[model samples]
Target: MKAGKLAALGAALLIGAAPAWAEAPSAAPGAARIADTATDEARLMALFRDDARREDALDPLALIYRGTAPDPAALRRLFTDSQLRAQRGSVIQSLALLRRIDRRRLGAERQISYDVFLAAKREEAEWLRPDSIALTAVRPFNHFGGLHIEFPSLMAKDGAVKYEDSADYRTNLALIRAFPTVLDNAVARFRQGLASGVVESRLTTANMIAQIDALLAQSPEQSPFYSPVREFSAGIAASEQPALRAAYGAAIRDEVLPAYRRLRAFLNDEYLPAAREQVGIAAMKGGPGLYRRYAGRQTTLPVEPEVIHQLGLAEVARIQTGMDQVKRELGYGGTLKSFFDVIRTDPRYHPKTREELARGFAEAARQVDALVPQYFSRLPKTRLAIEPYPAYREKFEAGGSYNQGAPDGSRPGVFFYNTFDLPSRFLTGITTLYLHEGAPGHHFQISLAQEDASLPDFQRFGGNNAYVEGWALYAETLGYPMGFYKDPLQHWGTLDDEMLRAMRLVVDTGLHAKGWSREQAIDYMLANSGMGKSDATAEVERYIAWPGQALSYKIGALTIQRLRKKAETALGPRFDIRAFHDQVLGSGALPLPILEAKIDRWIAARKAG
Candidate 1:
């Protein structure tokens, strides 16, 4: 739903930094190491490890991102322009080194790694260009995608940043102290965007203003950023607690809150006024090219926006027909549009209270967990916890989302379901939502990759939208095999959710590439699916905020589903479901082409066996 780069920015803005670049690694694959002396396997592994370490070193906030201790300089450095260039230079160098590897000498498994690394390098190479960086660099933060929204989650008491001891509190205090600089930089970036005609949409700017206002409404102790102070670890002595609390209070009042106020004022006084009156990216300068670039990176396929738009239309129609069939089967007298209205309006379909919604997700989680063992063999050892979205973020967030844990399984993955608007949150979608965002969806794909020590960190932690989101979307279809979508209503829920993804393909391209107005896009979604106005609006705004991202869900899911069909057709009875899954998830998050090649090879081997 969001860009990974923004997560880094969230931490980057939190921590301090330097612009130093270290020398290249000692061993150069293929150029220096021969296959005779060392297997291609060992060389590639070393190459990958070196690449990861180099990246981690260059990123002072990498520790914050990976749930490790903050760097001593983390609080000192924001994403200074020089530092951004330094990071890009590292990627380019890594790309050059990676291409030096001899693919011919690599074994089949190593070949996959080679392809992934090469593809990543090439992709990163595209983003390094002045125009590419300028597209996002000028507009560094957005209401939906960047540090402004994500900072709370990173700073929350039970959030990604761990609070274990006094040192941890101090690190956070330093991050808090450093925020004004980041916000000032954000203002500067917004000014750059204004100068370059790359400003965000007016709608986006306004929403961001509201987001800031919400934060400002919270008292110092209640501020999401102040949570660490409120819940000081029992490990700390009571004698020291008051001082720490006061320090946190002072920082939030003087530093953090004031920074947010500055950001809010900038959004209101300058940025919002300059925001584009037009809704679509196509309306902005160089937006068409930028949208195309995003479409490529997001899907990791050579798909044109026109092709995506048409594909979306076809998918929308097909899914609608399926929904019609379900409606007919369910003996509904009304037309499909009427049924959609019913679906939206029915009191029974909507939850009565936030607790009911939370409990609903909890119950669905348990039921989905029961079905996981039969769907595929492996279950993530990393526990999945279902909870409501934090109060500050719920208004802007989707119905649900997943936050992955550390690879080592020391921390459990969290599935945050929005219980904000209880009545608008339909009960019908609960089961499918859990299946998509929880078990066999994000938790399984993300946690399994991290937990697999055999895989390199790149495979374990790194991900592309297609494989990651696609696998989760594909997981939604498993409801039938798992026997959960049996009730025609629940079945409709699956279709609605699936239709949401399908419609995303149409609506995303429509809004971003095809020049569909926000209202136009929202209307198209409401007509096509059972989603209420609120979710539809938020989603349309999301596509606007993060262009081409919505395409990945349906596009990726279809690719995986198509590959499954191919495997099932090729091996027939020999196509073991568990084995097929193992092959897919075992490789970590791969690009569609790489995943297709790997799955085809697996199918061939299975047939021979």
Candidate 2:
């Protein structure tokens, strides 16, 4: 992995020049002039390799969000356009980054390094996953044909607007070119798993099929995707010449539909037959090991499964104790579970309309954003937009999500509230949710990281799942101190929200690792956390589908909390929350250990100062 190589190079550079950067603000008296010019070509080659690795990592996201088409003609045209841009960009970026390395200085390793670079480049060029997957599994998901509309107009109003620019199209084309090769390997893996009687959930396959059918059922002209195209074509008659419209229409009707139909056929004829009814990553090849790798990657620590399991157990216990205290304070409950029932049945918590519910969240987020500047001095320059979840994807999205803005300042960060089901958008724990998902959490951390140019691309753009989610969870805990839980009910609501994360630790580990059935996990959550049955069921299913990812929230939050306490104690009255936060966020999203090390360094520096 280029991970170790990158770290080694960074360390080597640091060791060679730490004195230069770390010297006092005033010049060191009589310091010998250091004009060291020893450059490591080996290190440069490693950086080249790491840059390729970075591209490989980002390719999947580009493919997933580009657009959807229902038929072969449209799909092929999209392939010709969107996917092609992504692939070409990946190869060009890889080659360009590789070229930046000084090859001649590598001595004997020069040819081998060049060969490795070429091999990696070829591999990227040869990847067919984006196209193949779209042609197979993904095609079924792209129900929107040429109706090409981007909706929720909430984004456009909030200044998070982005139009299809030539650059966007260029990037899309790059992915198309690389899509085929990636898909080939993926299909081979899928087939091998099928041969061994190991496959994905039957439910996942069914969902894909159902989504595809919905798309196909829509008239070609009525598709959400086509409307935008139509509007665009009509609006700029000169630009949307006859040839372009015909080509667009032809692509939608021909290439896209056939791709969807082919995928539908495979799901029905082959893949679905071998699919398992169960929903957990545990059943996959190297299941436990793979999860551990994910855990390590997400948390940026070498946390063992057993340790996490124990941590989950402890969190569940601690939160349940807090809930008991809250119950007594409220003075109207039988058991804690019954209080949860009361909250669920309570009318005051539920909003009457989707718009009302969405406005509630947006207002709460705005309130929090207002308070954030007091605590954080190093805030991101980028803007934030609040929007309702897109309608077509609401069924798949859990309550809310935060999609990062573009890196080049063209787009603002987005926080989407899924208000499809109004009753589901109750005030219960809403304030805490806002804090965790928006201000002082994801918005603060992710935005700051993206804005930091001093950090390497990987640190700024890449992330440790644990640190990001964990920090957010920690932010929720910070609400009370910030005077957010002024309402007693909101205070109880905050505790309830924390209890949910605690429950995730147990339920997620239960379903995937501990042989707990889906129903069992759902019941445990519903009874313990007082969540609605629908919410509880969906949460359990998400855990089953995505494994160890749920564990990162509590685990990551705990590490940050621990570090903060350590810093506070070390600096005493001199410790500034703003400075401490700047130190934490300015470095970007690093692994927990790296984060801790950075924090420790910051603390010691404060002490010395």
Candidate 3:
């Protein structure tokens, strides 16, 4: 999973906008027509910049995440319904302007931008429909990607927000004071969900309640929100420190903690009883259609749930064969199912301490870094850091996740590992997990795009799940050529990780589309791979909380792999691995179809040369 405010911004862009070269062309000959085309392209570029500025103004957090300062008033309005309506209206207007542009007038690069921007607006329009918002806006959050989980991290010292000066501290203090409104609004939305029968699942409701309980347990001084003021930056005068600390503590005690308590009471007393026992969204009112929309939006393709389910099954079977081969090589004397049990229960494969786990990942990073230049021609300027999830969050988080750094390299990207259940954490997965979440994965893909000033902001900062997660998943395969998988244990780990993505294809579709119980999904995962029971349960609940998202991993990786094979087969010895990689990452994240089309064009250009 990708964490942080910037990741949310990327998803918002994917889920959400555009502009005009809206005038009709003149009926002039030769030079006059060429001038019209150039004018249209120039106008379109201006429109892109203008729309991006409006978006930043609408959500000041976008600016903060990109290392730019934002108006403090805009920050206070971040999560309100009025803001949501304004964003929806913006999408509608942008799409209308985009439709007026003449696609034939643009050159190749502009044409690609035109297509991506149009597709994003059209998808956002579908999601913003009244019927769609009825199902989604009412259930504003879940345990997985909820603001309740992400907001604290965003406000922390290591998070996206800056603390360079006293003014910056003052801005952060104002943001913290405004957090209560966001929490109260969530309570209002949950009530709406209850009334409309679009409520969250009981499992998710329970998890969220537990999370809030953890937050409320902390005193004002210990709160993550107070972290910024704990150590003042050099820019703050000695005279101002005492008052700033007192004000922050008062905000947490008087406002933040009380709001959390109120939200907690509502969930435990009112919402939990109302939350559905059935985990899948298919069980809710208008759920099936909502699931279909989520599936389409997430994958960027019109695909049937049953077809994806079938594809997942085939991939799982193919991967299990490889698992069986690894089992034989390890001299295991039992069936694959029994082998899974041994791997899960074996103490040697599990880390004894958090430090041990961190060391393993750090070593993996060192090894992968040494070999990176052999695989790719370009690298990111933004640095990557490894850290464990905060204590309050580790219990519910996945095995690992990446949060992007500032666009200007002011902050380094962080790879957060889970150390809550140390015994349940597998040391075998360190290399593969680091490859997927850290270097050459999210860290490289996101940082490289943000560093390039030439691309439009939409291409630089906006992306869909299919391309973003898919590229990370594809990065895992690079382990083979890099030789980390040559060690049989590491090879087994890679197979297990691949199995996780393959199983997501089956398990996610099964839970949402086929009405599989949460337990059923967990049991299937345990039976198929070496994952621990705790990890497996977390994975199933994640799918239940956010449907259709898991399907992107394998769906995306398979597409990229197929395209690479096509390039290799066509070019024969002329194909350069580094050049192919650069082509893929060059334009940032794109919808699957758009990426495929772009790669095909590159192939033709290379062959012609």
TM-score of each: 0.92, 0.75, 0.93
Return the top candidate by lDDT: 3
Q: What lDDT, from 0 to 1, does candidate 3 have?
A: 0.84
Candidate 3's TM-score reads 0.93
lDDT tens string, model 2, 1-609?
112221221222111211121223222221111112244464444554456354544444422322211222222333233555555555555544444445566653343334334433443443333432332232222112111112212112222233254333233333333333333333444565576555666766666666657656766554443443454422345554444445544544654455556656766688888787766556654455556655554554555666566666777677788778777776766887778888788777677777776777777877887788877898777677777776665655567778777665556777777766666556766788778777878877888877776554545665656778988998897787788776766778787778778787777767666667778888888777766676776577667656677877877777777778888888899988888778767766655655665777778778898
**Candidate 3: how many backbone clashes?**
0
- Lowest lDDT 10-mer window, candidate 3? 1-10
- Candidate 3 lDDT at 55 equals 80
lDDT of 3 by residue, 42-71 (tens): 757766876687688887766767766577
The per-model lDDT (C-alpha) reads 0.79, 0.59, 0.84
TM-score winner = 3
Worst 10 residues of 1 by lDDT: 5-14
lDDT head-to-head 1 vs 3, winner? 3
